[model samples]
Structure formats: C-alpha cells, structure tokens
Target chain A: MHAIVCIKQVPESPSVGIDPKTNTLIRQGIPSIINPFDLYAIEEALLLKDKSGGKVTVVTMGPPQAVDALKEALAMGCDEAIFLCDKGFAGSDTWATSYALAKAIQSKAADYDVIFCGKQAIDGDTAQVGPGVARRLGIPQLTYVCKVREVDLEAKKIVVERLLEAGKEVVESRLPALVTVVKDINKPRFRTLIGIRKASQAQIPMLKPSDIGCEEEHTGLAGSPTEVVKIFTPEPRKGGQVIEGEPEEACETLVQKLMDAKIL
Target chain B: MAAAGTAAVRAVAVRAAGPRSRLKQRTKRYRLPNLRLDEENCTGCGACVDTCPFGALVLEGAVVRILDSCTDCGACVGSCPSEALILERPKAAGPAVDLSAYKDVWIVVEYDRKGVSHVALELLGKGRELADRLGCRLAALVLGESVSHLTDELFAHGADLAYVVEHAALKKYRTDPYVETAAQLIRKHKPEVVLLGATTTGRDFAGALAAEIDTGLTADCTGLEIDAASRNLVQTRPAFGGNIMAQIVCKRHRPQMSTVRPKVMELPKRRDGHKGQVVKEEVALDDEKFLTKVLEFVKEEGSTVNLADANVIVSGGRGLQDPANFKVIEELAKVLGGAVGASRAAVDAGWIAYPHQVGQTGKTVRPKLYIACGISGAIQHLAGMQTSDIIVAVNKDPDAPIFKVATFGVVADLFQAVPLLTEKLRKRLGK
Candidate 1:
C-alpha cells in the first residue's frame, strides 16, 4: 500500500540562461523548481497514500540543492523523503539517469509497493526515464497515465487509464508497478501550515552510489552512451509583416499576402 | 550486406598500417558496442526482453543477457531493472563518418487526388537549402502511377532532379509496395538526407523504408540543420508535450532520414520556366505485395479546415466563458476567412476538441495572422502560435501576455469586440 514518488528539479527557464560557449545551462543564480509534471505524480501518490492510509515517500536525484524540491514534496504531505546525491551522478542522460534511479529504487524495493514518476522531465524531455526505470525494475509500466481508475490493494492490482492518440485505454497491472503520470492526472495540493512545519523539521535520507549499489562507471556521464555534441537555442522567430489598416483592408491585405506567398 | 563488406574491406586496409600510424589508423576504426548487462545487479526482471524491438535480451539464470545481434539502439537499456543494462561508447573509437556513398538530398513527394501535399514543396525548399550547403543535387522521388506530369512541377518548385517510380501498386500509400519501391530507389541512388512529411501515410511509409534499410529515422522534426563539422543532418523535434526540444543525429548511419511536420517549413516558390532532369524508374509490383486492399475511403465530412495550412487563425480561450460562446469567435473567424483555434485550457474544459487547441501541449501553429480572443497567453499556449506573422489580441485584461506579442492590442471585453468585429467584417464581405 506504500507509494514512492520520484521527483526532479529543473531550471525555472523564465529566469535561466544557457552558456553559449559551453552548450550547458547556466545554473548559478538561477531559480530551480520541482519539474511541473512531477507535481502531478506527487499529488497522485499523496492521493493514494491518503486513501490507503499508508506513507508516501518522495525521492529525487540531483545536487545538494535539490533538497529544496524534496522539502517541497514533504510539505505537500509526503511522509518521508530520500535524496540520491553523489558527484558521480552528474551529467547523466536519460539512460544513465534511469540506471541510477532504478538502482536506488531497488535498494529500497522491499518498503514500497507502487512507484510513480512524471511522464517526462522538462529539462531532458526524453520521456524515456520512467519507461527505462520500469524496464530496469521489471515492473508493469504504464505511461502517459491520466487517471487511476481503480486500485485493489488486496489483490495487488491497479487499473490505470492511459492517454493515447485516439482515446484512453484502461490497463490493469499488478502492484509494484511503475506509472508515469501526465499533467492532467491531478492538481497538486498546497502545503498546510502544519505540513510546512513538519517538512521544515523532516530529516531526508541521503544516499550515495555505493549505498544504492550503482556502479560508478554506469551511473553518470561516464556511463552515458549518447552525448550532446552541441546544444544551441534555435534562431528566434523573425518578426513578420504587419498589415495595419481597418479590419476590411487588413483582411484584404492578408488575402493578397497569402496569395502572393502561394499559401492559398 | 554488400555495404557492410565494403566497409569492412576499407576498415582492414586502414588498420594494416604499423603502430607509428596508430593515431591516423585510430581515426577510421569506429566499433559500436553491444548493449551491456551487469548480471550481479540485475533483478531477473524480463522488462528489457519484452521491450527490445530485436530479441537482443534474454533472462538467463537470474540475470538479463544481451544477444550478439544487438544493433545497440539502446531500447532495452532503458527498461532494465537494477539499472543492469547500459549502452556505452566503445573506447578509442575513431570518427565514424561512412556516409560518403550517399551524395544527394532526396525528398519523397507525397501527392493525392487533390494534388501534392504542401509538405512536399516545403521539403523541396529545405532540400534545396541542404543541397546547396552540401554542393549536391536536390532530387524528388515521385512514386505513383501517372505522376510523370508532376515532374516539371517538382523541378519548378526547387527539385534539380526527379526520379519517377510509376506503378499502379504505388498509386495509394500502402506500406509494402511503397517501402519496397522507395528502398529500391534509395539503394540505387543513395541520398545523404531523405525528407518526408510527418503525415499519416508519410510516417507509415517512411518508417517501413527506414526499417527495411536499417537506418535511423527521426520523426516529427520541426527543425533541420547540417552540422558544419560532421555534415550530419541534425533533426530537431519537440518532445515530452513540447516541454523541451531534442536534436537527434544519425551519427553512424547512411541516408540520414527525418520526417518534418507539415506547415513548419516554407514552401519553395515555383518558377514557371524552371526545368530539371527527370529519370523514369519502374518498380515491379504485384497484388500480393500490396495485399491490403482499400475497402473504402470514408472521408470525414464537415467544414474541415486544413489548420496546418491555414494562413490566419482566430483562437479563443476559457475566458470565452462557455462552449456556446465559441460561436462568437467562430463567426469572427468565418468573416476573416480564418480557422478557429482554442487554448489548451479551453480544450481541456471541453469547450473545443484537440485540433482547435493552440499551445505547447496542443498544436504548434505559424499562421500569417493569429487573433487571440479572451486568451491570456500562457507560455505553453504561446509556444504553439507565437510564430504567427501578425498577432492581434482582444482581451478584457489589459495586461494579458498575448498583448505583448500582438501587433494590434485592444483592451476590451472580447464578447463585445468579437461580435462587433464580426459584424463589420460581414458587412465588408457582403455576407
């Protein structure tokens, strides 16, 4: 009945900048927030915890500063928090990332029955980590999950509604399964005064690579197969011509422009 | 197999030199590693085995094992439990540039009874750019019966050469014949970059062709560029509900392929007097290969707007209040002869369907004119339609983010302004 939610802290891009020369995001002095989608996963896990009368554990892998994200999750009703931070885990792509995370989850697999993750991380957007973690864990993985239709704790079966291109599919999978939730899953709950106080006093468990039994060579940049040879912001969209006039004249001018552009 | 043998021969010759030329020889031997499985850490979970496209993984004696036939695409590595699987770069691998055999840029010209899709022309434009950059010819592979008449049009639209694969079996898009014919054509005239439209048929056909040829194929690309150093086709696409954009490169594959979304690129201007060399190629086909017979094409009936090709779009948001209120925006769109769009908020509220939604989680639109009615543009919403040629904002909130991007901003209630504007446009149009 216990649920574990994995969260990530990504750059708050509105106030962030990417170093042009290094092809890396400038993180210093930039505000970092819980990945927006992860909020939904945390909310879903909290909801399950509330219904099942069990604890919810929030987990994250990042630098020491990522404790802020775990604290935020704890404030939002998570019973416990875990931070898998090690210098060796830096610069991990989705492949290496899922590896380290899966190992961390496996290290504590006996304590949790269900694992939840956001559909994808905003920073990476690979959407591969959840599936990757599921693959590594050998669990039934449901992705792009919009709704949890039913959960039978006794039977250890969960029915989830996955969002597909045409319609929703109700998939029934056994417990100890992984579900990657989409943004539409649930609205995250706000922290109460007591919850915030509890979070402030909460002692989050910190784990290193050795603690999780993750090989040093396979948990970070060294383990990553693919490398971003270069990263460049796309050219800014050029301003287009403004056909300023009365509505009628503007419409006429637009039609003419479209015709001239051979778009019609 | 022949290509692999030729590559092996070249690799052997390059390696035959002594240790004094080790650095030079090392620059040519790029050996790709197989998927690695760490047995001690494996949880005996069969996830990777089920997920692997190729049967490259097997659960053997409490651990997952990698087969020798692994292509190293790293599909299974993501699914391994205990983080047991890894796709690592082989050490001291040299620069892997083996794309010299492919010399031209080819675009698959997708056409139907309604003439060619605009994406074909858009690819022609992109193809022209890439060809010019590479100093290679831009060609079109027009596959259909009686498509010979389209060759001149292809040339006029930027194609320097047109290879016609004419056959009745290749008339309508089905996977088998189209892929076989396209594969044959590619095998004969290897293209450095093959561009396809991210349409239903184009995706189906292109995926099959890429699988047949055993090459990398990036889908739904919004941007394409040539890496100056590697001369590699960098295919960029919005991933994870447009949260981040990914640029993918087919580093060690020939005929680097990508499918671009329709309307994302500009169509080349057609010149009347332009001419190109047309090479007519015939593909032998039979009914057996094209087994899936078209039962009937039941086309959806409605005032169907080709939103992708729409030059102007009038989009509404949840501020419109009700589903019925969408009619006001629709009326304005009708008068303006523009398609109606909605923000994800409105769409999620069931005020409109997904097709009308204009946002990051929805469709990325680049219309000539985008009219925002009662829409406070969220960053996700702006990501979709911010590339419009001219944006006009009509919102009650004066500080709505849409106003910042709007060429014309009016601080007024959209309910009042939309009806008045629609009436004015109706009168002007004599409707």
Candidate 2:
C-alpha cells in the first residue's frame, strides 16, 4: 500500500489584515506554517502507513519556501517529499493548482493506493482542490472524512466516515481514491528527534511544469476560469450603545433592548 | 476579438444595475485592457477622465481616448452619463465561446425525511431574483430516492421548474454517482447558472461536478449578481476570514456555478398553493460502475452541532475565565432553547469541544440572535457571527471589539451580568 498526502503552507495566523491604502494583503512580517488542517492529513497518512506497512509521500504546490513545509512533514515520519515549485505555477487558483497536482501525481506517484488532503485550507477556505484533484484524476472522492474505519486491501477498498451537518455516514470506496480528512480524525503527532535529524539531511525532489508535462496556458493565473475582479476591505461594523452601570442595571437595559427589537 | 500586441477588448462593461460606487471592480493589472469608444454616444461629459485612477482615459476632441497605460479596471466605464465608455476584457482569457446556448438559472435542492433544507429554499429565493433580472426561468434540480414530494415545496418557495432524478444509489450522496448524473443533466440542458448551498454535501458535490463539467465554481459567495454587459454571474465572497472581499466572474464558462453559505441569503415565504412544472428524468446507471458505497449513518445524539441552523447561539470566550463558567452560557442557551458556542480561545483551552467553537476556524453562523459572553471580539470571531440579526455582548472591557458589532452591549462582569440577563429572559418568557 502506498499513501499520498497533499499539504499547503499557509500564513501562521488564519486572520489576515489588508492594507486599506494599497488595497493588498499585508504579508510582510507574518510567518508561514503547515496549514492547521493539513496536519491531520499528514498524520492520517502516517497512521495508514504504520498499520499496513507502506511508504507515505507528501506533495505541495507553492513557492520555493514551501520546501520547509515538506521538510516538516518528513519530520513527522513521511518517507518522501515532492516539491511542485515553478514560476509558471504562480497565481494558480484552485482549478489550476489542482490540475498541476494531479499531473504531478500521475507522472511521479501513479501507483499510489489512496490520496489524502486536509478538508480545507485556512487562507483560501475554499475546500475545492481535494475534490477538484479527484475529479481530474477520474477517481472517487470522499470529503470531510472524520475517521478511517478500515483498509481492506484484499477487497481493494477503503472505508471511512464522513462528518456532515445532518450526521455522520460510513462510506466505502475503491482503492486509488481520494479522501479529505477533517481535524476530528485524530490529534497530529509531534516531530521526533530521530525523524528531525533524518529530515534535515533528506534531499527533497522538485517538480516543475516541464517535468510534469503541463501546458503553460493551463497551469497559472491565465488558466483560471474565475477571476477576482475586485478586492476590498469589508465595511467595519459600527459600535453600538454600551451600558456600563451595575450588573443588574446593564442586564435590564440589555434585555429591554432585545424585547423592543422583538428578538426575545 | 481584441488584438494581442496592443490593448484589446475582452468584454464591455455596460451600465450598472445599481450605483457605480457600489459596484467594486477587479485587481489584476497584468494585461492591457482597452475600452471601446461609442463615438456616437460620447457627450464629452469628462466623467470618464476624472474617474480614471491612473489617468488612462483622456477627453480628446470630445471623445475619450484610452491611453496605453490603461489596465481596464472599468472605473471610467461607469462614470459616463451617456453610457459611451465600454470596457472590454483582454483576449488573454482564451478564445471566447458562444454563450447564447446557455439559458435559465438552476439550483440543486437537498432534502431528507424531515423535508427540504432551509438553504435550498434560500437559494431558490436568490435564484428567483437572478432569473427575473436575466429574464430566464428559475429551476431546481432534485436528486435522491423518493423526493418527488419536494417539488410542491420547491415551487411554493420560488422555483418555476423542478427536475427530479430518482435512483436508490442516489439515496446517499457519493461523489461519483451524484456528479455523473448531474453532469449529464447539465450538459444536455445547458443552464446559464447553477447555485448550491455551501453545506458539507453541497461543497463536496459541487467541486467534483464543476471539475467534471470543465467549468468554474466559486464557494460560499455572499452576493450573486448578473453583469448587465457580459450577462455573467458576478460572485462576491469573503476570501479569508472577513478582511478582504472579492467579486469573481466566470466570463467564458457556461453554467456558471457558485455555492453560497447557508443562512446568508434571505429565505422566501412559502405559499402552499404555488405550483410549477415537474419533469421526471432518467439516466443510465449500473451498480457495478459505482466505486463507492454507503455503509452506515450515525446521527449526532444531541442538537449541539446545529450551529448553522440555530436561531439563537450563546457563545463564550476567554472572558469566561474558567471552564466552569461555561455553565452560565449553557444555562442561557437552555433557557432560549438555542445552541452553545465557544470561541477558539475557549476551545483551545479545552473549555469546550471543537464542534462548539464559532469563528473563521470554527463555524460561520447567521443566527437570529447571538449573545457573546466574555468574548472580546477577535476579527475571526466577528467574521462568523457579525451577520446575526441581533447581537448582545456582555464583557468586562468596555473597549472590546465585540461591542462594535453588538446591537446591545453591557460592560459589566459577564459572571454577574449573564446570570441576571438569563434570569430576566426566563421570567419574561415564562420558560
């Protein structure tokens, strides 16, 4: 069994502030870390590897600095790392990004049994790429998965539980499928000393558009179908009247206001 | 077609349906975009000249001349009183496909034994408006086993047509069968726009469906509008948290798809006698072709996880000080028969479970009433609940940002204020 995990390096803080004057993201001092949700994906892959005795490979598409994320995944017991970095990949939206990742997987790791991705990235919060990649790969997708119930290699199938708004559903899909895991799946493990030492000396392989045999027209901002026409800071909510009297007085004022507003 | 070397026209920006200032335009300044001059309509009003942020438009001999510096931001297009300035998109977006084949607006409706979901009806309401504006029919795509009864409710809400496809395999949504059948229907019918709720099922199904159909899809859009000039769907959504709002458009793609967050749109009033057309359709499906299967379902014992649909939510934050103080919030929620929510800080401190957390990393809720106790409003937290109809904040700090969005704020100790507030509500409502 071979497990493939896709991860992203996002801003350390989920909350980003915009520069009102320039109308751009203020990304100067903020650090980058593994996306919070991707941690679960990486951990889930390693857990699958531990149970079935297979290798786990981590993949990411970003700038050169994204190698740090792959290295961190290596420190978490992943066997190999693939860095998808290139100028042509710049400004790729979910569609182009997923296309590039799918191309790389087809070229580099086509023999994998299952692919794992975090439910959604915090910065974009789109949750589209996992299913997008699955669609492009012509594979089955099980998203918002909270638990991996079983891996029946003999049956060539994987069973998992998906957490939905209404309830949880236990779903079974064939091998070579894609699963996007939520944070409730498991608590991610910390990097080990031995694993960190091995990661520091590991040579991460980098894949470019040419290596993946991707078309330049279909790999970047130009290839994206949906374009962000305008970006602006949302209007700030106006401060309301505040009552600062004793607890009883404030409570009475608040309740009366709710009653008058017919919210009660 | 717009020329390649020099500035070329992509698409024109006709007159706005609303005010110019209200419509925000795009940020990419890469390609040189040129506006077509309707010389006959030019009145030399000089509005386009002043509206150009980069001085790219100049009033030359009574007609505005677009300079080489123009990036086609469309700022000047709206300023022309005679509607003479028409901005066209750069041809780099790829060869323009004929969009005439696409018509009507459709929303995929989700339902269960309990009946249709509220978000589906909300989409119908918004879909009705968009369709009316575009002068097209509003339709609903209903998929599941034995869901024909939902057509009546759908029509009563807003849908003019209901496309029902039933199969036992579709009783539970698996990406493979659901996307396959929906794609088939969409390919044959070619609707101009498709809307879905950004629920777990909708998000899961939409991405795969859009990808399979080779179209663009926007997620959790807060605003959907029709571009008068291009007849495109302009989707506006909060990008990350709530700081930057981006308006997206699928100019070249047919069947423009977008998923809106539940409760974000207004739910239309249901008229029981309202009726519409119901078309029963069948598609080829073999059980052997499906690679996925549903094994079992486990419904959450309590209603604690229903934050998205909750009418009232009482959320606690670090202001609660200790985990035990969560009891006060729970007590209030019980009295109001609402759900209990917590801030990331409280959830991180192990005061409550992760499902109860509300914010950017948590749940984005649009409840009728929200009571924030001890929660100093973080931007992320505000992003989640600021849309609530009525907000009441109880915090010790008078300057907390939570007060900014609160409809009514109390700057007293939450421990003292919350119990009193809860007690008063209980007595007044006779609960």
lDDT of 1 by residue, B1-431 (tens): 00000001112122211112222212222222245677778899776665432234556788776543233444455556578877654462333335688899999998866677788999999999999989899999988878988887888888999999888887655556677788898988888899998764565455456655656566677889888898888878764234335566766666888778777787789898799999999777885533233322333223324456677788999789999999998888787677888988898898876556676545567788788889997766776777677777777776677776676666677787677677765765677
Best by DockQ: 2
| Per-residue lDDT of model 2, residues A1-264, tens digit only | 889999886655544444458544443334456777889999999998888898999998865445667777888899988877655665566777788889989988998999999998776778999999999999999998989999887788899999877578999899889999887788899888777777767776556688998987776555667766665556756667887678898788878878888766
Off by over 4 Å in 2: A17-27, B1-97, B321-324
Spell out the clash pairs found in candidate 2.
Answer: A229-B25, A229-B26, A230-B26, B10-B88, B10-B89, B11-B88, B11-B89
- Whole-model alpha-carbon lDDT for candidate 1: 0.67
TM-score of each: 0.58, 0.85
RMSD to the hidden true structure, all candidates = 16.2, 9.5
The CAPRI class of candidate 2 is acceptable
lDDT of 2 by residue, B89-155 (tens): 3347643455898899999998878999989999999999999999999999999878998999999
Positional deviation of residue B50's Cα in model 2 after best superposition, in angstroms: 23
Question: Total clashes, candidate 2?
Answer: 7
